[model samples]
Target: MANLAKIVYRPVGLVGGVVAGIVAGAIFKRVWKIVDREHDAPDALQAEYSWPKMLLAATLQGAIFAAVKAAIDRGGAKGFERATGEWPGS
Candidate 1:
């Protein structure tokens, strides 16, 4: 049962990861637009942005990505458990 759960979870996890990334990107874009109306948040390699601004964008993006990933992973695990009658992890 656990093996089957693991097998089924692979594709579900992949799809969930892709979806989570898209959702996180959209969320971060909207948030950046709202917080910094004059310009888009700078990428790490861009030197035009100050340390504080760049750090803020990095922190916000990380938080959003983590939250979305956690949500998607948990949801996928729950669905897998429901379908297989076995938890995917020990």
Candidate 2:
């Protein structure tokens, strides 16, 4: 049963992760626009952007991605358990 649940959860988890990424990207873009007054965040090798700007963008993106991923994963697991009466994670 546990193995079956794990199997069932693989696709759910993958979909959840992809959804999280999309959501986090949108959020980060909006935040970057508001905070930096720019349409796009600086890339690490953009050459025009300073080290501080690149690092700040990376840090903010990472934080938002992590938060959104965790929230989505937790919600998916809870929903799965509610539907199947089995927790997906150890």
Candidate 3:
């Protein structure tokens, strides 16, 4: 039963991860605009952006992605458990 639950959750988890990425990207963009008054964050390869600015953008983006992924994953797991009475991780 637990194995079956895990199997069923695999696809759901994949979809959830994709959704999380999309959401996190949007959020990071909005946040960067607010923080820097720019439409886009600095890319590491961009010659005009300073190293500190690029690093700050990278770190902020990473933190946002991690947070969004964790939130989505936990929500999915909780919903799955409620529906199947089995935790996918277990």
lDDT of 2 at 36: 94
Query: Model 2: runs farther than 4 Å from truth?
Result: none
TM-scores of all predicted structures: 0.90, 0.95, 0.94
Error of 3 at 41 (Å): 0.3
**Weakest 10 consecutive residues of candidate 1 by summed lDDT:** 81-90
Q: Judge candidate 3 against the unseen true structure and give its global Cα lDDT, from 0 to 1.
A: 0.95
Global lDDT scores for all candidate models: 0.91, 0.95, 0.95
RMSD (Å) of each candidate, 1 decimal: 1.2, 0.9, 1.0
After superposition, the stretches of candidate 1 with alpha carbons farther than 4 Å from their true spots are none
lDDT of 2: 0.95
- Looking at model 2, residue 15 earns an lDDT score of 99
Q: Which candidate has the top score in TM-score?
A: 2
Clashing residue pairs for model 3? none
lDDT of 3 by residue, 1-90 (tens): 989999999999999999999999999999999889954899888999989999999999999999999999999999999998999988
Local accuracy of candidate 2 as per-residue lDDT tens digits, 1-90: 888889999999999999999999999999999979954899988999989989999999999999999999999999999999999896
**On TM-score, who's better, 1 or 3?**
3
